[model samples]
Target chain A: QCSLDSVVNKRIQEALKEYKPSIPTKTLSCVSITSSGRLSSCPAGMVVTGCACGYACGSWDVRGTTTCHCQCSVIDWTTARCCHLA
Target chain B: QCSLDSVVNKRIQEALKEYKPSIPTKTLSCVSITSSGRLSSCPAGMVVTGCACGYACGSWDVRGTTTCHCQCSVIDWTTARCCHLA
Candidate 1:
């Protein structure tokens, strides 16, 4: 019984040493709108709306000027934005 | 004034047609533990703990078997898992 208790104690210690909380390293990037009233190309992780370039590029919104929204839904790459419409 | 009203109506119509809600395409991956009491490699955009493989590989947790948590933090690539420890 004493030996079993010792083994259990060792296992508990090992478990304590081995346990680690999961922390996510990757972060999502934010979307941006361009000044020319056009949507811009988003970086790899980001999606472009209303912008005329990059992934998921298309007309997203129109007002006095074309307003576009670029967003990154992924976690690895940082988001980016650029304009193409004139 | 009548011309202004027609132009305004046309603009409203265009605005209605142009509006699109922002939708994210990328999704985050889930974490998992391996059968060998070790952590498996997580695909891109995922964080792994316990199982020992791939990026950010290390011990994440242990029980009857070693279990690792793998997740994808980025958006471009789908998450993957593999075991390295025996």
Candidate 2:
């Protein structure tokens, strides 16, 4: 039984050595999505990190965790800074 | 030899079962850092995903991969939307 356990431990260690290299190294990736209106949204599987607005409007908010809505009344465009794990 | 191989394979499977739950499930975490000037930066180990500025200024760019630089002639504040995997 002792010899069996030792052999199993050695095999497990070797298997782990093989498996460690297959683990993924994930990174952050982002993109900008702009629309010719007051609101813009990120694509599926992405989240909005921030927003930009036209007409020099600094006021904005995120809606539903995905869309950017510029608060200025006369805004012509909106941009969503979208990001995801890549 | 065949019996030893079978025992080793069973042990490897059990070891993998124990290890799978220990793997980290990474997610995206973000924060907004606001400063009382034209520039703001993310903390170390974080990256800038986007930026915001005061005085209704929408023109801006990232300086380095961590800092947000507002480009308006008169800016009172800057916000860096920083993110990282957690």
Give the top-scoring candidate (lDDT).
2
Candidate 2 segments whose C-alpha is farther than 4 A from its true place: A1-21, B20-45, B56-73
Pairs that clash in candidate 2:
none
lDDT of 1 by residue, A1-86 (tens): 67655655555555446545343444434455344323334434333211222333221222222223323222222222322211
By summed lDDT, which 10 consecutive residues of candidate 1 chain A come out lowest?
A: A58-67
Give each model's clash number: 27, 0
Q: Candidate 1: lDDT of B68?
A: 38
lDDT of model 2 at position B56: 70
- Scored by DockQ, the top model is 2
Tens digits of per-residue lDDT, candidate 2, A1-86, equal 67998978887777676674456879887777888899999999999877888777778899999999999989888888888777
Ten-residue region with minimum lDDT total, candidate 2 chain B: B16-25
lDDT of each: 0.33, 0.84
Distance (Å) between predicted and true CA of B3, model 1? 95
